[model samples]
Target: MTVYSSNVTRGLMLAAAFTAVVSRSSLRDLSSVSPIGYRIGFVTPQRLWTSSNSGRGSRPIGQIGQQHNGASWEEISNPKSSKTVKLFKAIHKANKSRRNEIGLTVAEGVRLVADLLSTENEHSKSLVRRVVISDALKQRAESPDGDQYHRELIYRLREADKKSRASRDKANAIIINTGGKDAVQACCGTVTSQGIAALVEIPTYNLDELSSEGEEEGFYLILDGLADPGNVGTICRSAVASGVRAVLLLESSCDPWSPKVVRASMGASFRLPVIEVPGDNALDRISDALKIDPKRIFAATMESSGDAGASKAHFDVDFTARPSAIILGREGEGLRPKIREALSNGRISSVHVPMSDGVESLNAAVCASIICFERCRQFAQKKSDDL
Candidate 1:
């Protein structure tokens, strides 16, 4: 017989180790006749394996090993399966009608769910009904954040799911996996799926609740007829950053819970008070409920032919003087006639950013950001002056 080197024997041992690790049952009765030395434990979805030179002869590996403790998982392969299709419909066809009927929306990408995990808001955390992940996303390598951050996210999600199950709460969030890459792509329109997506109940907040007099006094950002999801999302992110107390989504505005808007918001939607105002007289209802003085409300607009109805510059307004509300209008048309009537009658003030002669107007989202930060700046200045 040919003489085998020690290295060759070691290679054979490693092969046995892998086989035993993947097939946990096989290791239980592994024969000692082979010199393969390895230990396996199944505590999670991932397999664990270690090699050591057990002086003992080969007996069934099972006799030497502990029981596998991994949780059970289901693998779905069909993109058209009932579960996958339902998720696709909710995420892709996120119209008001669909959302109202289903009472759910999709939050996709790893960052969204990661942020959801970290949020301190109990109500926000409770809104998540389920988290669906694609196998491809689960195996994704670490991002620039760190080598272990992705793995850490998986661990935390699993832990949270475990606790939820133990509590047996109907609202507890569940963790699930898609059957394949096709299913993941179908759900979020991206093959990557950022490794995870969440099925979250659309949070409902009444305008009256946000306007309660007992609530802390702060600026409210009102969105009017802005149909672009990207703009709506960016405005929401900016509003959160600039310390707005709440955001009012007018009926004509795009769905705040839509996937595109959710992604664009960078998770700010979860932290902010996003109330829907679904009627022709949204502003009127809000004013009445909040007991808002017309003089304290401001509408942002492009400068008109003359200064008849519009404030000359955004900087000219005294945002910090009192509790204020800023209204952002539709993309192309600017504010509606009713809003302008408020401005013209001096019931509400109109504030506009002075632009160069050639530029007619800024994007709705950009205008909102500028006005919001201006308010932040003014508030900061006021705080400093008081000091």
Candidate 2:
């Protein structure tokens, strides 16, 4: 074999080292780049967000031996099978409290986080102060302004993630961790080249704030005594799609913000302003939110030919004329008696969808969808005619 030049090997290694160092180094000043910097979550020395993790060989950039620790350059890879959706309700509740106490909310995933940074919607943007992502958890600004900055995803994971009775004591807040070795790992490491790409952590938001964009004629669906995340999710997806404004939760209905619901919603949940009515008071809250005074509330039933009315089919009524709060109760029992009182006393009228006699009722979500669409259709058509 021909003798190889040691000089050649040395030269190549040196070239690779310089490239790694430059490419991986955190931007000391954002102004240095031509692109506008994102006003990120609350944290400091914004570079700290990037410095601790990115330079650590966790990134695609090779040639840098920069501390891979136990995680090697050859090993770090893309998220293979991401089954769970965003950390929704738990995160939503946590941030909702933050909004009440401090005016902030949280968002997960690269696109959502990026959109918040770039969003034109005044209601949902800017309220972010902290963010946790596998791909990018960071504290970017040298100081928080108390304004806004990026904090490394790990800082929050360690400091805020521990679940205690004290944390659970809050109604809406929750602490959810990505659950496995394959999931993103937290690190105290200064260089995070080997870290997982779970960047979003604290989505910054609390729904207590009303929209400044102006509220719609605003009707909401309250899932009471109903169980099943998929059913709740389907109702929510349809509600948002048909312009029901928002959904209110009063029972142990699956957290509409959970990963499953979010995916089932097909992104409608983000666009809707759903809120929870603590405990069994959900029906009351639904009445209040719609300003129906419970006096105008209505029961939807499958029962035919009665004064409180029959299964008239939800669309048969003058949906636009009626200021209504409707309920789809438990699967087998249908509407509860307490809920029926308002309807019986003329506090509300009972309405129903006429289905085959043997067909007990539609899927809770399906019923809600058909009803909501009918109401909105009337309103939409009226609006079109007015124009």
Candidate 3:
């Protein structure tokens, strides 16, 4: 009887220990759960989750799985193994020559990709080479509760693929699923990716395309040696918004097709005609292309005492009066010597945006935006007067 009692007591003690361990583990797991009920491990870099009120524990909508009809889903566990993934990485780092050789650039984020797909221009729409999406994005797009924009994007992607297969076009955009956020992030240029990106064929345009002979008198934006990709991209956005005829990028300028510039442009690069001008006698080449005298070109310069010619305020110039080109220079260096010489020689006039006494200069992008919008305001006022 003594042995039996001892054995029973030992067994009870073991059971109690097991229960305590289990209870501790349960508490730990419960503590790890977010207030919204989503597991912390499941949260994406994009933080694409919201609280659910249905009492069903919250899960990232993007992580939910549903098969999209007619879409070919492939698992890309390793980025190195996939040629498409490698191509995307390469394009992101490519120089002008390499990018030209590849004839491709990347457009990331949901909005940019959607804009590219939905553009009214058939040529621009056709430029989509491939669409790389995260498995989460694909799943979310298929979910009934997903955003309408995401759903439409997925549908368009499928349609685009189907049309390509039907037409047997070699240039059809392949829809790829990375199977997770990591692989998609591998192909993105941004620090925090949107889990979706598209490879787009770079469109080439010649100087002649910038001509606005038959239409309204138009102005052009000449980016002379603007090295900052962000500034270049922002200028492109402004140029498009202000109805600039085309953006002339000098040889020394940063690659306008670079991912940073494209993102800054906010898809404006896809819409605008961007021409590359030779570094040598770029002004003359621009003059020849527009068939306008050199005097029509205006260089944006800072106010200086040693200036060769008196600079006019941006608003004083009547951009609508004739076919004009506004040349913006590098951030620190301003215009190249030849350009400055042109300003001094009365070949091209110099213009400046007036500023307060303390400020030395505005950011290249900010300056470009201000000047471009001033032209826009002038055009609007002119239109109002005509009415």
Candidate 4:
């Protein structure tokens, strides 16, 4: 409370009036600020001046929340009530009928989803219906220090979305944010969730589609009553690596679209054509698909002293001679009666992976891998010899 000169008092009064006008103008401009700077606008004096810039040639506040990449980010607070979440749960529960009805399945884990997203196949890319990511994961992925793979996945998703929007064909994946880690974890089928998942449409194929081009030789893998998902998945992965034309699953076989199988296959299910043979005459249908003599089909059997001449070692079979179909049966039980009867009648040949004495048998997956790779090795050698 000190006295001031007349000139100083007048200047103080002018400053007070100016400050009052600015406070009033800022309050008016607060409503025009974007969500990005809403809280800062109230505390920072410069933000008050920036609001006018938004209207005078700067980016509009309305456009601030819009992604330039055309991808839509939706926050799901109640994932329990979300339709995507329900679908994910249904797929995870292995409700085969429901899955078939919807024609959709879930692919979890970052690597698995990333693989699907990054694939160049248009059909494969179109199969990705949705990508569900946790909000925390999204933030981490967008962070400066995030993994390059993770960032690339995000960029690819956004670019895919943009392409879909431009084409208006719904070929892109819809991105969903679960808003929390728990929601994403609850949707995952694995013990440790990676906070990301994708809904994939099951691809359909026909017998005609299984045929190879021209004289290019290839083989088919038939799963006869293979109920173990792990074994089936591993075999599928090996088949794809060894270049099988397609995988045929008998009606008695486990669902190839199941989460456990998809996980164990490590994305091979999406890359390879998996067809289901529904009727009891699966062998006939498979033979027709192969378009080869039934004798070319080989049944994988275990080695035994009693069946020395009856079965040939897998490597001994001339797989490069013609197109072939290899049949791998369920674990514990070797081949079904139908397959054994066919083998005995010379309708199909019996092949066994030679094992050392004292070993009863190899895992079904291991057995398939050995035979498939051996076929590949033989064909490769034959190609080199011809060259």
Tens digits of lDDT, candidate 1, 158-196: 766666546533234354554466666666745556656
lDDT string for model 3 (94-161, tens) is 56665554456889988778777874656557667667788888889889998988988888777776
Give model 4's TM-score versus the native structure.
0.78
The lDDT of each candidate is 0.64, 0.44, 0.69, 0.68
Q: Which pairs clash inside model 3?
A: none
- Model 4 over residues 243-319: C-alpha lDDT tens digits? 98788988788989898888889778878778888887889987886686688888888744455457788878998
- Per-model TM-score versus the true fold: 0.75, 0.51, 0.77, 0.78
What is the TM-score (0 to 1) of candidate 3?
A: 0.77
- Ordered from best to worst lDDT, the candidate numbers read 3, 4, 1, 2
Off by over 4 Å in 4: 1-72, 171-173, 212-216, 304-309
Identify the leading candidate in terms of TM-score: 4
Off by over 4 Å in 1: 1-72, 82-85, 119-121, 141-149, 304-312
Candidate 4: what lDDT?
A: 0.68
The lDDT leader among the candidates is: 3
